[model samples]
Every structure is written in C-alpha cells, then in structure tokens.
Target: MNTSPRILVVEDDRTVRTVVNDYLSGQGFSVTAVDNGSEVLARFAAERPALVVLDRMLPGLSGDEVCRALRATSDVPIIMLTALDAVPDRIAGLESGADDYLAKPFALKELKLRIEALLRRSRQAGAAPSEFGLGPFRVDPARRHIRRDGVPIPLTTREYELFLYLLNNPGRTISRDEILREVWQWQFGDPSTVTVHIRRLREKIEEDPRFPVHLKTEWGSGYRFDLRGGEG
Candidate 1:
C-alpha cells in the first residue's frame, strides 16, 4: 500500500511541469501532472490530492478561476506558481485562495518544504480535537473550522492558522515579522503575505472590514485581536 501524499501539479510549461513532477516523485510524493487549468477540478476530484501546485497563467479558465472553483468546496492547500512576482500579482494569487505563492524561478527544495509544511499542518489540525470560543467566534479544531455568530466562515488553511493564532493571543500587538515567523513558519519572506491574509480574515469576520472591531491594527506596531470589542 502506497500511502504517499498525492500532489496535483498544474503548469502549462512543459519543462517546468516535468521537472516538478519528477522532483516531487523522487521525494516520495504521488504526483499527478497536468498542462492546463481546465483539467484541475476533474483531476482534483478524482485524485483528491493532498495539495495543488497551480500556475497563475493557463490557456483557459485561468488559474485564479480554477483556484476559486476549488476553494468553493475544499480547504485543500494550494501553492500558486507565477512568473509575476509583483506585490499586486502575489496579492491577487493569495486573494484567489492560494495558501502559498512561488515565483516562476523558484527553488524546488523550497517548494517541497512548503508542501511538507502544509501537509504537516493539515495532519496536526486533524489530530487535535478541541472546541473553544471567544466572543462571537468558535473554533472546532478537529474539523479545522471556525464560526462567527453561529455562521461558519470559510477560510483557507493559511487563513485559519493566522486567525487562530491571533484569536489565541487576544489583545497583544503582533508585528508582521512575528506573524510571518509564527503563523507562516517562515523566517524570511514577503510581509505582504501576512497583510493580505489579515485583510481576508477581517473581510470574513468583521461587520465592516474597513472599520474592523475585533482584528484591529495598532498603528505602526501591528495587529491586535479584541474578543471583548467583538462580543455581543
């Protein structure tokens, strides 16, 4: 019985796809490689991959469209690959539901490390069973779920991690660097990653994202979560 984690690699570039597939396979992952976005959902449904490596640009459907479609029904971790390394481009990828983003000219080792980290988190989330509440929010650790005012809020893996981290800390101001290190497990990377995730979390939980009550920014310091302010 081969229980290696399955991985779906969606890249239009032939060379890149082949290299990634070979590398991941060599690293003991069961890789299903595809050439376009159109095949992503079918493959995903069929393979039920542990993670997806998606290209930002595709011949049809577009990577973002495919990502959004997958996110509609699954919290599966997704890592977006793109040549566009601009802040806005990365932000767009993250906004479209990618749990992580890598520039086209990226290291394969880094990709493997990311995939391992996500899988590890997924497993840990499943193994833990704890039900906790703070104000309007409730966390179901076993289900990897969080609800606001009795309504479930859909969050990607990364978003959920960030939310729980902040919720656990309560009112302490946390810097972007600290968030990146703790939540993302990255000592060095774009700070925008944390910023975008925070924005997304606010949009989902806050009555008004622009005037967030629970997840508040502490000026130049960072962000603070206030359970009392958000409590009814």
Candidate 2:
C-alpha cells in the first residue's frame, strides 16, 4: 500500500517541475508533475492530491484560472509560484484561491517546509471531530465546513483555519505576527497576508464588513474574535 501523501506539481518550466517533483519525492511525498495548466483539473480529479504546487504562468489556462476552477469544488491547499515578487502580486495570488504563494527563485527548502505545514494542518483538521458554535454559526472541523442560520458559508482553506483559530481562543487579541507564525506556520512573511485573510473573513462572518463587530481590530495590536456583535 503506497500510503504516502500525494502532491501535484504544475509548472511549465521543465527544469523547475522536474526539480520540484524530485525534491518532493525525496521528501517522502508521492508527486505527479504536469507542464500545462490545462491538465491541472484533470490530474486533480484523477489523483485528488493532498496539495498542489502550481506555477502562475503555464501553457494552457493560467494558474489563476485553474485555481479558481479547483476552488469551485475543492478546498485542497494550493501554493502558487510566480515570477512576480511585488506585494500586490502575492496578494493577487492569494485572492485567486492560493493558500500560499512563493516567488520565483525561491529556496527549495522553504517550499518543502510549507508543504509539510499545510499537509499537517489538513490532516489534523480532517482527522479531528470538532463541532462547535460561535453565535449563529456552526463549525464542523472534521468536515471543514461551517454554516450560519441554516445556510452554508463558503470559506477558503486559509480563511477557515483563521476563523477556527480565533474561535478556539476567544476574547484574546491575536497579533498578526502570531497569526502568521501560528496559522500560516511562517516565522516571517508579509503581514499583509494576515490582513488580507482577516478582511475576507470579516466580509463572510460580519453582518457589515465596513463596521465589523465580531472580528475586531485592536489598532496597534491585532484582532479579536467575539461571539456577539455590538449594536449597529
């Protein structure tokens, strides 16, 4: 029985793809490498990999497009690789359904570490049967699903992790640095990543994102998630 976790690598660059595939395989993962974006969905459907390492530029359907398509039906973690190193480009990748992003010329060791972290989190979330309530919302961690007032609330993989982290530690202010370290499992990275995810969470959880109540920013500190919202 080959029980090793499967990883799908999507990169147009042959050298990068081959290197990543070999590296991940050496790291004890079962890797499937693809060169074109168009093949991503088919491979995903067939393999149902534990994670996907996708390049932003590809021969067919761009990375963003493939990401969006995958997100429509699955919450499998995606790490986007791109040549664009600007803050906005990273943010755009996250917005396009990537759970994490790495720029071109990245260290292979860091990529491996991130893959381990995401896979660990995914396994933990799935194996644990945690059901809880936050105000009107119901969280089922085992299923990676949440609902409010009988309606399902859609959340990206990162958003769900962030929400659950806050819910588990209620009332205490969680610093963005702590969030990056804990939720993202990154010792250092753009704080804006946390900011972007928090904003997206507020939109889905708050009655009015413009004046959020449950997920409150502590100005110079960080954020706190509450069960009840203040009066509008």
Candidate 3:
C-alpha cells in the first residue's frame, strides 16, 4: 500500500528536470518526469498524477495550451514553471487555468511547499460537504462542480475553492492576505494569483463582472461575497 502522492513533472530542461526529480523523490513523492509538452497529455493520462509541474515554455504544445486543455475536462492542480517573471505573464498563466505559478530559478523547497498546500486543500475540500446551495449557485464539493441558475460554470480548482470560501463567509470582508492564507494555504506568495482567480471567478458568477454584485472589493481591504445578492 503506497501512500506517497504521484506527481508528473513536465519540463524540457534536463538539469532542472533531474534536480527536481531527485529533490521531490527525496521528499517522498512518486514522480513521473517527461521532457516535452507533446508527451504531456499522453503521460498524464497514463500516470494520472495527483498534481502536475508544468513548464510554461515548451516546444510542442506550450504550457498554456496544455493548461487550457486540462482545464476543459480535468480539475487537476497545475503549477506552471516559467522564465517570464513579469506580472502580466504570471496573470496570463493564472488565467490560463494553472492553480499556481513558479518562475524559473525558483527554490525547490518552495515548490514542494506549494505542492503540499494545493494537495492538502484539495483533500480537505473533497472530504465533506457533498452539496452546498449558495444563493443561486450550487456547489458540489464531492464532484468539485459549481452551477449557477442551473447552468454549469466551469471553474478551475483554485477558483472553485475561492468561491466556496467566500460563499461560506458571505457578507464578511476578507482581506487579500487572509485569502492567501486560508484559501491558498500560503504564508507568503505573489498574491497576484488571488487577484487573477477572483477576476476569473467574477466572470463566471457575476451578472456584470465590471460592477460585480456578489463578489465586491472593499477598496482598501479585500473582497466580500454577498451571497444574498439581488436582495435586500
């Protein structure tokens, strides 16, 4: 009975790939390493890893393309590795459906921590609350499904977790740092990832994302989800 989590590492850099493989293996993960984006989908299907470490710049499919494809059908957690350290590039990666992002030259220890956080959050979210009816939305925790007005709104794992957290504490202002701590389980992170997930979730759940009614920003504080939206 093997309890170690299986991980898929999709990276083209040989040295980085070896280093990561050895580190994660030492950290007690079952790792399957692949070199090209072309083989990612196939290997992913075969390995069925608990999480994916995807390189943003790949020769064949590109990480964004792979992320989009994975998001279409699977809610697996993805941490995109990239050399692009720009904020816009990070936003693009988040919006493309990665659960997290790590710029190249990232600390392997930090990457391990991020992976642990994501897997822990996922396990907790899946453990209970088979169903939740929040205002006009239905959140199925067991299946990781969310629906609004009887229409399914596709959400990445992070988006779903964020939405669920906000819904659970509706009408209360949650600071960005608090969200990062509670939702992402990160003591310190880029924080922009939270912003991107919130923006994407607004597009799905809000009638008007520009002037969102349910998910509202508190200017200086953070955000509040009015589960009692369109009501007094």
Predicted structure with the largest lDDT when compared to the true one: 1
TM-score per candidate, in order?
0.96, 0.91, 0.90
lDDT score, candidate 2, position 133: 80
Q: What TM-score quantifies how close candidate 2 is to the native fold? A: 0.91
Q: Which ten residues in a row have the lowest lDDT in candidate 3?
A: 223-232
The full ranking of all candidates by lDDT, starting with the best, is 1, 3, 2
Local distance difference test, each candidate: 0.92, 0.88, 0.88
Model 1: lowest-lDDT 10 consecutive positions: 223-232
- lDDT of each residue in 126-164, candidate 1, tens digit only: 578689897888999998899988899999899999999
lDDT of 1 at 185: 95
Best by TM-score: 1
Better of 2 and 3 by TM-score: 2
Question: Per-residue error at 169 for model 1, in Å?
Answer: 0.6
lDDT of 1 at 37: 90
Q: lDDT by residue for model 2 over 165-216, one digit each (tens)?
A: 8888878889999999889987898998898888878888888999988889
